[model samples]
Target: MSLVSYTKALNRALGDALAADEAVCVFGEDVGAGLAGMTLGLQSRFGAQRVVDTPLSEQAFTSVGIGAALAGRRPVIELQIPSLLYLVFEQLANQAHKFSLMTGGQARVSLTVVVPGSGSRAGWAGQHSDQPYSLFAHVGIKTVVPATPSDAYGLLTSAIADDDPVVLFAPAAALGVREDVTAPLGPVPLGSARIRRPGRDVTVVAVGHLVHDALWAAQELAGEVDVEVLDPRTLYPFDFPALARSLRRTGRLVVLDDANRSCGFAAEVLASAVEAVPLLAPPRRVTRPDGTVLPFALDLDRALQPGRDQLLDAIRSVMA
Candidate 1:
């Protein structure tokens, strides 16, 4: 087994995709230099044609990726910042995502949008710190937030190979995560959830970076309560079957996510569990308050985000 960082896993995935398929090309700003480290050494390895360093126009280049996909090229567009997603929302959510359905399955845009450093990067503040997976999920875009290095490698490969447009959000909080991987790196099927920790008392569903927090909280409260950790790797096209099975075993649910409260991914998970299965206790969700704009100050920023204490309280509340 070899230990690998999450950022390295991402870089490996991009390299593997480029090596495996000639049609797979990457386009984004500063890709020539691989400024984000996710695309490092890719331009030289894959050549300038395949690893394109696009102009500063995100909206225009985003649509260009869609066009390339339509022309039979699997284009992976790397967005250095997560908020840039808002700028090209129409290009992605409307054009790239709607192609297959709008054309009655005749047209497919096999495109992958990679947001390398999503979520808060300490003092990155309001504009650059948003974790917008919920936005893509709401529009039915295939969205993935991988917590571990292995998942980062596997899911990125799957997203590149998918026929539909997929958005892969690599949360900044999780970029530092490393794992000891024994298995040969490969693709993890989309729309699947993994049970990180098994328990019978309550299921703690964590999103993106919160998976680590959930696991820690579960361990901290191990003697007092049994907490199961469920990581829904793919936010959109969620693995409802796996979640249902966990819910059946646990009978209680608590969601810990970094997104805002109202209409967030956590809410969707809670709602779905309640609607489909019987709950032994009222489910709870720990997330940023509704309409949260992360403050610039250190304490204020930390205050607005969900943490271990909030997750622990939610678990206790559900147990009570």
Candidate 2:
């Protein structure tokens, strides 16, 4: 088996999509130079037109992508940072995302916005470290967060192929993750959750990079607590049935999320799961503090983000 890193898998997915569809094109600030790593070497292979680099303007370029999508082009916008989502929120939420619903499915905007390194990147404090996938999910837009290398490949392929506006976030922490591959990578459905580890004690639903933290906490507490790890590959159009099935086996729940505590992804998961399934104890969620703005100091940054320790505490609380 060959080892494939998460970024490489994403690159492969983008390459495959471009090769398969003549209409597929990419727009971003430094995509041609491939500064984000996921678009590395793509420009040289796909030609300048297919992998066009844009001026340093998220609003202008994202608007261009929206227009291109409306005109029958499958444009993938590669965002260098996650916070750029805020800059283009009006364009994404009001313009691109609304086309289909506003026209009653008559319009199709096959646009894919990919944030290669989302969430906290050590020193990339405040503006750069936000994990806002939950915001897109809240607004009824398709939102995906793949945890592993293979899932990264599959989910991204599916996102690019989707006939609507889809936002895919590759957590900063998960980028370095590598996996052993024995089979070909392909598309994973937009709204499916994967059971990373199965157990009977409690179900710990993790989003994006926090999946690794959940797995680690589960292993660390293996003897005392039988923790189950569920990765919600897609946040919006969430696979509630999968979560329901897991909750059937384990009567407790805990969500490990990287976003802020109030109205965050973790909050949504906890609220939805409690109503759908019966649980043994009160559900708990471990997340960044509400209104948390990550500090530039490495220690402070680590402190602000959810970690395995917090996950373990939440899991144990749910089991108790």
The TM-score values for the models, in the order shown, are 0.99, 0.99
Candidate 1 colliding pairs, count: 0
Q: Write the per-residue lDDT of candidate 2 for residues 1-320, one digit (tens) a residue.
A: 89999999999999999999989999998898888888989999999999999999999999999999999999999998999999999999998999999899888999999999999997998999999988999999999999999999999999988999999999989999999999999899999889999999999999988888888888899899998999999999999999999999999999988999999988888888888888899999999999999999999999998888778777777776
Task: Give the distance in Å from residue 289's predicted Cα in candidate 1 to where it truly belongs.
Answer: 0.8
* Model 2 regions lying over 4 Å from their true place: none
Report lDDT per candidate: 0.94, 0.92
Please report the candidate that would top lDDT against the real structure: 1
lDDT tens digits by residue: candidate 1, 1-320? 99999999999999999999999999999988988888999999889999999899999788889999999999999999998999999888888889899999899999999999998888888998898899999999999999999999999999999999999999999999999999899999999999999999999999888999999999999999999999999999999999999999999999988998999999999999999999999999999999988878879899999989989999999999
- Model 2 worst lDDT window (10 residues): 311-320
Instruction: Please identify model 1 stretches exceeding 4 Å from their true place.
Output: none
User: Measured by C-alpha RMSD in angstroms, how accurate is candidate 2?
Assistant: 0.8
